[model samples]
Target chain A: MKKKILVIGAGSDVAQALSRLRAERGHILWLTARSQEALQPLLADLKVRYQVEALGFVYDAELHSAEDLMAQLPGIPDEVHVAMGYLGNPDRLDDPKDAARILKVNFSAAVLLMNAVMHAMIEKQVKGVLVGISSVAGERGRKSNFLYGAAKAGFSTYLDGLRNAGFSHGIHVMTVKPGFIRSKMTAGLPLPGPLTASPQQVASAIIKGMKKGRGTVYVLPVWSLIMLLIRNIPDVVFKRLNL
Target chain B: MGTPMSALTKISNWGNYPRIEADVRPWPLQTESPQIARGMGRCYGDSALSTHIVDTRSLNHFLDFDAESGLLTVEAGLTFDEILQVCVPRGWFLPVTPGTRFVTAGGALASDVHGKNHHAEGSFSDHVRWFDLLTASGEICRCSRTENTELFYLTLGGMGLTGIIKALAFYLKPIETAYIRQHTLRCENLDETMAGLEAYGHWTNSVAWLDCMAGGRAFGRSILMLGESAKQSELTQAQSLNPLKVHSTKGIPFPIDMPSFTLNRFTVQAFNQVYFHKHPKGSRDSVVHYEPFYYPLDKVLGWNRIYGKRGFTQYQLVIPHADARKGLQEVLELLAKRKMSSFLTVLKIFGEQSENYLRFPKAGFTLTLDFGISASLWPFLNELDGVVERYGGRLYLTKDVRMNPDFFRRTYPMAQEFMEKIKALDPTGKFQSLQSQRLGIHA
Candidate 1:
């Protein structure tokens, strides 16, 4: 069955990979990125490569209201994937404005946007799958990126609640916790080879998880084990060690 | 917008020679001048390396594809592998491709790479309709035959010195199936091999694997492989069901770098002997998937590692048709005399030369030999370069790491003209590579 899918933050690496995978399956795409110029190429690519209908709209999570953005979609999507994220500089925590921006973009904006989409899906009685791309950093906050991790933690908690709430409504919400993705966000980081997953790997995992109706998914299975081990570490020991 | 991150990293091309530490960063959305653009770093030498390199892999995106005319538009960073994955299933194939499908379209244009079918088709640029080049002044110029004609011609095989290729439009040839009807002929010697290549010139694609180590009686003994796109009717019942199936098998990974001593002359000779005898004499016909036919080495991921950590260089040179026979024999004789063994040796005939200023392909017999890096290799190759130049042949810029400026200028008659045009286009010397600097090509 072909799906009508909506991808938020279409400019993101994981989202672009996901969109391509979905388009390859002959799904209709409605994409939203901060810049329509950035989204145009992907839209055209999906349209031509897969002969699928793809539409793009300008949407800045910080600037635009979720209600206004949701209103722009032609139809209620069968699946909605939120891939927007900002890996702000941990060194720049001295500036509260930058810290707030990261928190809002990764957590507040994502929550409001998903809330709007969820309401729209409920109003239309569409039993859609909502996928939130959270991060493994949220599993246990470390000194390296506790600020961004905290924001993702909030987003992950929100998705967990949404998953329970949507269960009664016949809607499925999946939380994706990816570890060390090889994307623009982590381009320069010295990520461990065995631990890092490419955007394509994460995208395919999301699709597979969506198909199996999984509540939560770790893009790389080992990430779940790694996060579990990290979570179980005593605060005294974890605080003494640098992650 | 925040400043993009940059890392001081050690980088080298496929040959892995003369590795240097440079500041490498992703191409900025709004790029500034004076930075060299690199995609996949597949160029054999310094052509893709510079002090400051802008990685274009992030810029990969498909812009458009007109299914009716088979015209596909893609960003510069898109690889042939990515294109084939999408296009082949739809019965469309690249008009021209090099031995490996890992090369980016922009890199292909910059090098003007030739394929097995060069005698039938042409270089990669021959099929290019037009391209959007980000000039030194940050102006995006649409270049083609008529528009910005000189820039268009210069940009092809220009080594990305003229500017960064942003996007390009090229025509894709429609294919009935993905499988190739292959015919192989085992030749006894150089005379027989050359004759075989000419006799099978009518075939859509042709290439020969020559055993350079085989001396005297077996000198230039080779197997000529000819291919034509297999028709649906020619495929077996199992294959006919999915005639357009693209190869999805993962290549066997070359897990570790072999020790330097592992690929010495004796081992290479033994391998070559085994390879040569594997194909039966006379004509043998078979159906093969395009992957193995077009890119046999790609099956061994990081096969270059077989040369070990010191790395190796592929010396690919082409001599004009009139002098080709003598030139090739002289080169092969030198290799045999020196007891220098090149593990992989290939011979092909290119039909006609494109007018593109710096493109390597010409109407000639082109031979490629890969030599592992050794103490004597550098000076030995220099001697070989002299022999090649004497025969009115030129080395492939894409494969070259150490051709002196004088040799480059003498061999490429249009080097001066290319320099003048580039100077006018990029007066500030904004777009230059280590290759351009080494060859004395500057704005």
Candidate 2:
């Protein structure tokens, strides 16, 4: 049976990649991004290339309340994927406005958007999955991107709590932690080739996590071990090294 | 939830030149219309390039088939290789295909690609029955020769500006064997090669490997290959093992981009010299799998990287039969005079005319010259475009990158009508590719 999946940020390459794999097996997709003008071509392309029903909406997650955004969707999605993230230039955090903007987009906006989806699923008694794509950077606080990492850490903790709450309600919550993906976010960075995974590789893990009903997942299973090693380091020792 | 995980990265087509920083999103199976469709990025130029591209490689799927009627329905993203994998085992094959099977159905239809057997089998446009096109307005318009007839013509080689093709149904050629019986002839000079090609024009499939480096009286030395689909009785022992199975060549990838100087004129000239001498004035008849017969270059996986990081451009032009000899002579002379050498040189004859607008073939002889991308390539190609324009021929859009609007309009007689048709389908002018923008097609 095809699952009615709603992708909150269809413009993201990870969401697009995940949908590409699932839709081929007859998954129904509902796409909502910041702009229909930008995501519409993707919907049209998917409909043509996969011959699947891909509906897209111009949804501004930051601007609209979750309930208002829910009104735009047709029904309670069987699966909801919140794959939106924001990382402001680390060097440009001189102004308080930049800090607020990043926090609003990354943390507050995501919670508002997913809360509406959670309420709708509970109302409809939908027994399905809620997936969120976080980053492995959230595992530890580093000076280079500690703020963005803090926001993701907060979201990961929120998902862990959501997983506990959803377990009693017949809903599953999965938090995806992708490390050093070769995406637009890390396009030009001189990251180690062996350590980096492509969006497709990350997307595949997300799907696996959903199917297995796992609470949290690292994109490449190897990243899980790497994160474990990083997490066990004492703060006194970890703070000395620039990550 | 909104996903902002899209990463912008630099990607290029097969030529590996003109790499651009593009926001490559995965193909959203369900969403609004994407700006452009990019298949395997097999096109040698900017024709398939876009800053914001919907990757079509993931959409690849073989949907339906009818062995009795030889009708195959496939998603636009399905590659020729996938199609052949299924159909060849069922005694069916694509009626028309390009030199490489890596191309997706949508890419082939968009370019109206032709094969070595073009004189007999024609182009992809001729074999297609109909296709489901997702327009800019997000409507799935069923297009065919009889239905939505206007768009049908324009979309055939329309460069995909009409819409994103969703699915297409086409007729396939049924075969009893997967082998092609070929007869090879070695020609001593330009006149002999042309004469040999003419003699084999009626063969089911034929092509020539010309040594463009040959100068003076020894010019146009070539090996002319002529073939016909092997009958059941003519199948070789290896082919009969699994008559319908598709054969795959062992691929050794070019691990890294070769240095630009690796394939310079001196190297190409020497290579051509060796190739020219390899085959003397003789003939050989052999039976082989259809894969190698149609897609010889496919044997060399990632061979384009041999041209180095700048990539290469394939300049293909077809001139009227009347001017073929002189035009070819001039083309070769220009290359030799400028010391511009081509690593891969091909010559063939096109038959009849296509009803579809923007189709490149006519009753003429065609030549393909492959030049590794270099700093001086544009000016050299511009002069060659002048040569083509003077002789009344046009470039293949599939491999073109630098042709100007004036030359395009002059060479293709149906440019105005084609533009009008594209505008009719795309009234809001939504779809635009790098090639269309460069040629001022949208304006």
Write down the TM-score of every candidate.
0.95, 0.72
For model 2, what TM-score is found for chain B?
0.96
Q: Residue B394 of candidate 2: its Cα lDDT?
A: 88
List residue ranges in candidate 1 displaced over 4 A. Answer: A93-97, A139-146, A221-243, B1-4, B29-34
Model 1 TM-score, 2 decimals: 0.95
RMSD from true fold, candidate 1: 2.4
For A1-243, candidate 2 gives per-residue lDDT tens digits of: 888999887767788788878787788998888886667656755664456898887777567767777887888899999888777666445867767766766677787777777877887899879998888878887777777888888888888888888887799999999888766555435566777888898888888888888888887778889889999999999989867
Give me the candidate number with maximum lDDT: 1
Each prediction's DockQ against the real complex: 0.38, 0.06
Query: lDDT by residue for model 1 over B139-184, one digit each (tens)?
Result: 9999999999999999999999988898999999999999999999
Mark the 10 consecutive residues where model 2 chain A has the least summed lDDT. Answer: A183-192
> Which residue runs of candidate 2 sit more than 4 Å off their true CA positions?
A1-221, A233-243, B1-7, B28-34
Q: Mind giving the per-residue lDDT tens digits that candidate 2 earns over B1-443?
A: 11244556788888776788876665542334225678888888888776577766655555566667888877788899877876787788889888899899988988898988888888898899999887877788998978988878888888878877877889999888888899998888889988888888789888999988878787998889998888878887766877776868476676777888898788887998898777666998988888889887788789887877778888999998888899888999999999999888999989886877888998888999998877788999999988888888889998898889988888889998888877776776667778888887876
lDDT at residue B221 of model 2 (Cα atoms): 89
* Residue B287 accuracy (lDDT) in model 1: 94
